[model samples]
Target chain A: MSATDAEIYATRSFTETEVPMIELKGVSRRFAKKLDVAAKLARKLGADVKEEVVHAVDHVDLRVRKGEVVGLVGESGCGKSTLGRIVAGILPQSEGQVLWNGQDVATLPGEAARTAKLRRQMIFQDPYASLNPRMRVADIVGEAPQVHGLIKRGGFDEYVDEQMRRAGLDPAFKRRYPHQFSGGQRQRIGIARALAVQPEFIVCDEAVAALDVSIQAQILNLFMRLRRELDLTYLFISHDLGVVEHLSDRVVIMYLGRVVEEAPTERVFTAANHPYTRSLLDSVPRIGNRKRAFATVKGEIPSPLNPPSGCHFHPRCPLAFDRCKVEVPKLKAVDSLHRSACHLNDRA
Target chain B: MSAPTLEVRNLCTHFFTRAGVVKAVDDVSFTVDRGKVLGLVGESGSGKTVTGFSIMGLVDAPGRIVSGSILFQGKDLATLSEEEMRHLRGNRIAMIFQDPMMTLNPVLRIDTQMIETVLAHEKVSEDEARQRSRDALGMVGIPSPDERLKSYPHQFSGGMRQRVAIAIALLHRPELIVADEPTTALDVTIQGQILAEVQKLCATTGTAMIWITHDLSVVAGLADDIAVMYAGKVVEYGDVGEVLDKPLHPYTHGLIGSVPSRNKRGEPLRQIPGMTPSLLNLPEGCAFRARCPRAQADCVQRPELREWLPARLARCHHPHREEAAAA
Candidate 1:
């Protein structure tokens, strides 16, 4: 069946009209590398040492409607994870506003703030590292709900078991520690824990990246199933384009700390407008397309500490011009649902 | 074809741990001809890495090559001494690890490492070694080889460091190179560049390579032959095009099906059920029987790796019929 036949849920048709579950407006996250005493002394002695700041996420604007799955794609240190964290509310944005259901999250009252925090949950890449080894699966899944008083009195066991079953885990194995279970099983436990809190939105940062092909498929299937059953929205961050293409309704391409392109999954894959996106699509090795010469983006990803002058991808872009080095390209609309950042687009 | 660059026959590398004997690479064998690339594909703990280590004679401590002969151009590497192996290790048989840092020394300049590698392998002058090192760096697509050669390992990016490691592996123009996921840690764009360089290197130099990785798409594109390992054994082996297009073994079929691009988007992937069994105390007979959909009672008798079809070999009691595979 074609991907366009995605009719398990009717959410996609009315997505544009619905109030976005989460919205990011010009969000930016910066991390400052403080100079040590020795470096500070060296600076005073004319050693050219100075404090540096990494703009992890810079002026990114995004919106995820209820039940929408938006895939965030980028190379390592490109700020996809940082963007996900900002959306999840775990890491506060260095600048800009985060609106939850058309309400500012930062200025929300005590009860509303608490609700907002619990409603948006995150699933990390490494299942082994994300979970608590000391705690049993039962406690890991149920603790948040219990602590938050979401569970009915004396019904904790049944509640945790239901969550486990929903995530396709055998509830009988709930008493086992994280080390006892395999990688896929541990990911399921993490999903169960997220669902236990009744989250409306989930931020999965390279969730299935560490899994083997067969196991990655199983986990991706689980994510799809959960979305259909729970009507959940997702900001799925991943480096694997194939996985992103399979699940995401919309795809957002990031470079350094900026949003370079955003479009429907099919458009992003078939007719990518951004040079970076096009190069990324070309680089993906295809099964059956054997012995073909790989078309690569020219250079290594410039260090995020001091990104390129204008377009972050300019250094590696094949069609890079003098204008690309001096002026940052704005993410302008190419189609009703498609947007791209490239000087070539303006020239055209 | 030049006595086949490397022929591994019935190789078994096991670890004698306190708990039990873990047969990491059990009765695995494959042949790589001159200028041919053999892709060793498997999931974690499938012994693909161990097989690479076995060929390089790098397995140490509890892990040892218990049986089988690694014939490198008619010479038996399995029977070779540490001294003899060392002489051939960096000179003739080179290895590029998953992490570049594992191959590169962080403290030393790139030149010192590359120059020393040349001096250890051959009677070459310092100037000649340094020039060869510079040329090798440029060969792997690294720009300004002279400047890069002076920089420390930490100065280069992840992709550049990996390129440097590959250049070191190519320093002696080794007859055989064992690359264990050399590009796995690199970005997709960088990975593409590296793959292209390696592909061209093999074709031009006739340098046989054994590439060990878990990504099927990569293997499908780059390898001439493919070996699919499961639970420390090679369950399937054949030409890359033939094996991936119409796999004879159930494990190979499932693995090819599991790739996201192969499946219809939004549908559940054709995944194999159950996890890989532990190497220690592995079940008798087929290690994949528990997860194989076509497994039968005959699977109880350990299946031999025999010819299932023309040029295709699989360890299975009941290999998938040609008709079924075509469908």
Candidate 2:
């Protein structure tokens, strides 16, 4: 009933020995507020109006090898989705470099950049919001490929049908609009659209979080099946640790727009090194556990608009000491494949 | 034991729309003992919220409680007039909603809202009402209630705002509380904190609660009893531990099994096939027949909630025998 490590990893299309397919170095995205007319006038009057900058992602370093499923876990406004969008090139990072296939994607030549864009795709969280209500399933799924000249007009229907079949949708429903499909079916249409572009890597931002549990499972299975069949890699971003644990090869934990911890899924689940990661695991309600009580991590997630100095989590963390307030912890290796950012790790 | 605080018998609430009459809550029956929490677990459109609304007499014109006796402290809530029901509501029965804003006024300060709720229910002076509001906020783990009281609802975070809503609900010490997915919008830690506080309140004040949610694990932790609903009917009902450990109904079994945590990692989940039938046009027999694995031709007659074991009930044509379930 249980999968052995060898059995699980045997299905992996790529190994760690392979060079990273995508790498983010010092990736930081900042959003600056637009001042109102009054504020602009006040600033003109020498009131010393300081422009507020919301740091959505701060100096994050990440690597994803070919065919690896990296789960990004965090609470709301933790910059996980922003990070995902940055990877998929939908959003431009304010600073730092995004290297695709060890080459900087931004500096790539015109055609090369377009090629890179086609290789990496993003699947959004809400099926209803992302899909076009006016477009039929065929047009929605076939649009990208057709516009990009990947599929000829004559062969568009067949190509769309193939992508639909891969995504677990009946091709016969191609004529139906987004409104006609259920939540799961609409999500499949989204997936089919993404697959139509022939992507090698996908950044799924809370892909199944909106669906019911049963429908979620169906979608999760489809993702796994696609990964196996197409040798696809994913940067799967979700708030649900259970889903992340079920689907991820490695897990990355973020807090207030910073990478707090990174480890293989087993290591993160069994013995998390960071206090924030530990608390996130503790809060999940285990299905079969008879006793149901936990000391919840105190305090709400602080606003990302004005994140704390030094350690963002220190204010709410239980083991926070004086040193945690003044020093931003660098991610250091706790083990072979695990890295954690915490003041307590200094003792180790 | 003392009589159950709230007993609902054959409760059915239907929505009359231009399309057709939608039976949102169909012939549902359950009881919550004093100090006990009954978790009404179901997916969206399963009528768990309607059942809660029926108890609070909050179901609007389009929706009406057709037939059922909602016995609250030996009185029928279904028959109560709007005036009488309004008097009882927020006094002996309080309901919390999914969005804290549903219970909170966005423009008002926490203290003003809380004090008004208390004064409206009880004959209390302004100072005493304010003090009660402060105490209620403190009881739900909001820090510095006095300071929080002066702040507008917008100033509080999502978690804190929900706490304020919960505090207002508890100000009058209502005998029955119907919380409809109050913590669904919150983060896990915040949700755990609120659930812990609610559980403590029920234990300390002997308040009966009907906690309606789609999450089974949450129900397992918070509720003494659970009623798993499908297509407007409770397919299974029993003690939380007993029912979850050995769910008899196929729908309940499929639901529990579908949760990612229930399956070993890397393995496919034991998902129940097919989607829930539309509420407008449910199946002729058992509403769950379309998705139930054990469904047969004989499921045409809808099964009633009957005892499958001591203190346990399941509406199933083919419930798993104890031996069959063990394997």
Largest lDDT belongs to which candidate?
1
Give per-candidate clash totals: 0, 0
Best by DockQ: 1
lDDT of 2 by residue, B19-38 (tens): 99999999999999999999
RMSD, one per candidate, in order: 2.1, 2.1
TM-score (chain B) for candidate 2 is 0.98
Docking class of 2: medium
Q: lDDT for each of the candidates?
A: 0.91, 0.88
TM-score of chain B of each: 0.98, 0.98
lDDT per residue for candidate 2 within A34-102, as digits (tens), equals 898999999999998887888999999998887778999999888999999999999999999999998
lDDT of 1 by residue, B240-280 (tens): 98888888899988888888877777887888888888888
DockQ of each: 0.68, 0.61
lDDT of 1 at B33: 96
Which parts of model 1 have CA positions greater than 4 angstroms off?
A1-18, A38-50, B324-327
